[model samples]
Target chain A: MDSRAQVSIEVALVAGIAILVAVSLVNINFERLNLARELGEGGEAKMVATLIATSINTVHANGAGFELTLSESKLNFTELTDVDQGTGIILPIIIDNTRRKVIVGRNMSRTGHKGQWNVSVSMVPNNVVRQDPTARYPEVTIRNNGTNVIVYADSSKVRVVP
Target chain B: MSSNRAQVSIEFIILVGALLVMVIAVFPYILKTNELNKALSAARDGATFGAGIRGVGYQSGSVEAPPGRIKIKSVILERLGRCGNLECYRFRIVIMMPSYYSSNSSYVNSIRSTIRNQALRFVYYAFNGEYPASSVIYRVNTNYYSFNATTDVEYY
Candidate 1:
């Protein structure tokens, strides 16, 4: 080939390689952003779940009932009632199945996917978990459920109003 | 010939500089993504396993902050350890039995609530995506208080 033709061929190869590298870098950047958003959602969802769980736990722990006002979000509960509490007369806890719930998917409950996370929380184990937190909880307020309110969070001094 | 060599060296410098920029910009993202992915995976697993934990964490009105005072009921905080590299947090369920009202219904209820709340916090934060596992169950408590730790992690 002539010198000019050889130069043209070499330029084309270098340009082709450069284009490939640029495309790959762009793709990796996109993937990182997408993955960050996805993981953030999961983390946020789990944080909401943890917040709700703490509230319910406080209620059951105090063995009293209080109005649990949560922002609109998906909620799931498992009957933490002592299966072995033994049949005997004792102080009654007013927590129903609704209040005792430890919600997992906070977004699903509020978003279009209503009633989608109705899985029986029967899977009991001790270990780590996967969470996708994307529930927007601007505020959590406690309301009056009834008399005999034992304990309350979201407050520095949680007093029981009997 | 010298002019041509100068142009080639400039090209080489440009390539090296571009590589350095790419490394500086992209490597941190890769490392962060890896850490986040690890955190998400561990959190998910912990949440699933923690769901079955029928326990609580209890802090006396006197205690302030996490790894504070864990009132002993069925829950017990063995020890609290800080992170050497990162800030690691944990729940230590101290075995504080208010002897005056050991049998009192209201007092027992108070202790019970403390246990439940503390247990929950332990699992939740212990599995936090950040930091290493520096928290340990205190040695003072026996296996009896671990409360079927195999299935429920009853470290109260």
Candidate 2:
């Protein structure tokens, strides 16, 4: 081949290889960035789930002896006495529950992710027709981001009511 | 005829030499870039694992140790406060991978260095919290292969 033709071929080959390498590097970088984002999202979800579980356990152990009512929208531990409502006792319980949800929400919002969690308490009456003395209400379905968590409070379990 | 043949051979040799040089110079950059990307991805993966472990620990009422794959060095949990009426915990997880940092190649080394410093900070910011704006000291060996990490947690 003529010198000019040989030179043209060489230049074309070099350009082709460079373009190929450049394209490959760009693709690799894009993939890595995506993986990083996914990892961040997964981590946030797990944290939220943990907080939800702890709160339910605390409320089950200490909430005042109140009739448990479960509805589609609310789980009520009602009839809390004046003492039970005081900051000395109830504030910690409230704090425990609220904080768990808040952390989950804040993290999810910041990370642009979403998760769902729920907790509930219900009473099992002592008597069906006011006859049995061995029965008591127990808390149920305290889930942290869908992790099945069960915490029960036996009025019998309370040795010295605080 | 003999002289003409010799001239063609010399010209071919020159063309080959130029091609080899171009490949040598550019191929390393491409390969180095690839290695750096791989390390960055690994660092990000480790960070994600750290975050997940922290969350699990807070929920389970026990510190969930980071998975073995993550090579965690430390975990910190902070009690932040209630979310509405529920308790919350903030966790930090740190992991180390020696292979990522001790690379002799500049491309890999730069990426490894960047990831080592930024992984946790990225997680913290992603979680909507600010990281302390100070730089942490790191010691890297000649091969770019060792790492250390520290994580912090808060619960409310």
Q: For this target, which candidate reaches the highest TM-score against the unseen true structure?
A: 2
- Which candidate gets the maximum lDDT versus the true structure? 2
- Runs with alpha carbons beyond 4 Å of true place in candidate 1: A1-15, A63-99, A104-139, A144-162, B1-156
TM-score of each: 0.26, 0.28
**lDDT tens digits, residue span A1-162, model 2:** 466776797798789879977764553344345444434443433333343334444434444332232232332223211222211111112212322232221122122223321111222211111111223433322322222223233222111111
Q: Evaluated on chain B only, what is the TM-score of candidate 2? A: 0.30
Q: Score chain B of candidate 1 by TM-score.
A: 0.25
Residue-wise lDDT of candidate 1 within B1-156, one digit each (tens)?
767766766676687678778877997676544433333333233322222211111123432112222233222222234334332323333344335444355544444443443233233232331222232222111111111121122232
Chain A TM-score, each candidate = 0.38, 0.30
Error of 2 at A93 (Å): 22
In order, candidate lDDTs are 0.33, 0.36
